[model samples]
Target: MSSKRERRWWTEEEDQILKAGVESQSKQIGEVNSLMSWNEIAAMLPRRTNKDCRKRWYKVRSDFIKGTWSREEDRKLQQAVQQHGLKWALVSRDVESRNADQCAKRWQHGLRPDLKHTPWQPEEDAKLLQAMDKHGNKWKKIATLDLPNRSSHDIRNRQVLKQLF
Candidate 1:
């Protein structure tokens, strides 16, 4: 099998080219549709593939929109947590988009206030057992209903069958 070549980062010149092309195309099309396809944009640039162009486009858009997280934002996030036990999602919405896993990690890492400890209640155990009985191993869906706060990894670890044959 032939090995794929490594991708290079976009330089300032390429950024200029992409911006100019997008601007001109948008004006011509009377909208941004013509400029939205990264593959078409890549075809106009030198030595870049559709994937590379798309990745760079997303990065540029994110940096331009968010302007990177600042020290002041970090300070505010910390203060919000200390003063009112604010959720990371609420505090960091302006600084960064917090997905489910990121929010969990932020809480675990002490970036947010510690979540109240909630042990698996008896009813939760019964529901999990019943779901497992019906589904035979659809831990993800079962976890969603029975342990909404738990991660898939956590649910997997807690599975009795996971420890058995």
Candidate 2:
């Protein structure tokens, strides 16, 4: 059997060092330096592999945004969608603090003009339960195949509200 390495959380000091080292190596004119290997960066940190360093660098990127979308953000999303017509990465740049995935979800579920907002009926609830039983927490499958007009996020939220496993 192969040995698995136990995961270690990075300390603040380690993060600082990693950030400094990566920033120094990455900056060559305006783009990342292709000549600099992750192995070289990882060598600066104790017990961290090249893979770990690379993954961590991506995970802690300074530009990623999270949290609730605001009204202004919604307006920007709408404008972006109108301009770019579902080219989500381009749309994301126009909508501040949102990535392509966030923009897509917002448009598909929240901002879509044709999305229905009807209250869940008893028949729908029964169907949801039956679908959950059959699909085993695969919300997208349940949503698309079993419960039309419902998003995976909505299905998951409904399941939580009902305290269903």
Candidate 3:
């Protein structure tokens, strides 16, 4: 009897074949209830598994929604920030329909400088102190007045509170 070969990793060519096959099959299976299973797809592309095809399909969908930030995308994000003034949520939404977390992370890291800064301004400090003094640990109320734009609950636990109180 002949020896069987062990399965190996997929190559670029295999990936292309899998992509084409999935596209073709998906078109045919359109709107059908309980369409082709991953196992069937894998059988069609003998070298891969249902799991592999599923994973690749998920990755492709994610990439399409999140759109890897190209130089052009970065430029657009920057321009959006300049034009809209630190509307990171809006900019991120426009950049990619999915991966909002990824876009938010990019913005926080200064990969998107047009996003707003979260520095503690002196006026904010003063207002927080005043509100704290008046309310006596009423952080939520103080934050609303002192930093209306900020989520005050988060700011209540900052090191600045130690200095102020």
Candidate 4:
């Protein structure tokens, strides 16, 4: 086998450290002409070169916007979405720790009142069809008409599943 080690995925903790290092170095640049080189960051991590550390940071840069989601943040998101409608830009700024995309996803998938959390029942399925007939794929409107538990997300999901299988 070669002496070179195989590359592995960076962990969340590693990514956090990498981001902090970059940010810290940037902030310190004003006070000092010198800065923490990529060499310094690489030295902090085991078996990584300067290039490797730099490349890893860039690779996962988008992740800076998305991190852990707490129930409190979820509640804030729901309130923000409810107050502002689907304006992700507004909701994202109001709800800290989540950007626009994350806020939109959480609303679309889970927090929205239009999405029912439970599995579909036969009665619910029958109602769904009636609502669909009346509304014609306008899931948000259909949801408000009859289904108390069902959200537009649930309706859309059920509709697709019905059409497919």
In each prediction, how many residue pairs overlap at the backbone (N, C-alpha, C within less than 3 A)? 0, 0, 0, 3
Give the higher-TM-score candidate: 2 or 3: 2
Query: Deviation in angstroms for 32 in model 1?
Result: 2.7
lDDT by residue for model 2 (1-165), tens:
759998799999889988877878868534333344679889999899987876676567667566688999999999999999998767877885776677888888788765557787888789999998899899989978987677777888888988953
Off by over 4 Å in 1: 1-5, 33-35, 62-165
How high is each candidate's TM-score?
A: 0.35, 0.59, 0.30, 0.45
Residues 1-165 of candidate 1 have per-residue lDDT tens digits of: 759887676789999888876677677777443135667778899798766765565456543234243556556556655654545434434334432223334444334332224566677667667777877677667656655656544556667644584
Model 2 earns a TM-score of 0.59
Tens digit per residue, CA lDDT, model 3, 1-165: 759657687778777877776777778877211254667768767767776776565455535455466776667666656666555445554655433344544554445433224777787667776777778776557645655554544456653556676
Clashing pairs in 4: 114-151, 114-152, 115-151
Across 1-165, the per-residue lDDT of candidate 4 in tens digits comes to 899778788887777777777887778775211234888878777777877776676456564345578888998898898789898767876786665667887877677775568878999999989988888999878877878667677788889999998
Number of the top candidate by lDDT?
A: 2
Segments of candidate 2 deviating more than 4 angstroms: 1-65
True-vs-predicted CA distance for residue 57, candidate 2, Å: 6.8
lDDT of candidates 1 onward, in order: 0.57, 0.79, 0.59, 0.75
Winner on lDDT (1 vs 2): 2
Clashes of 4: 3
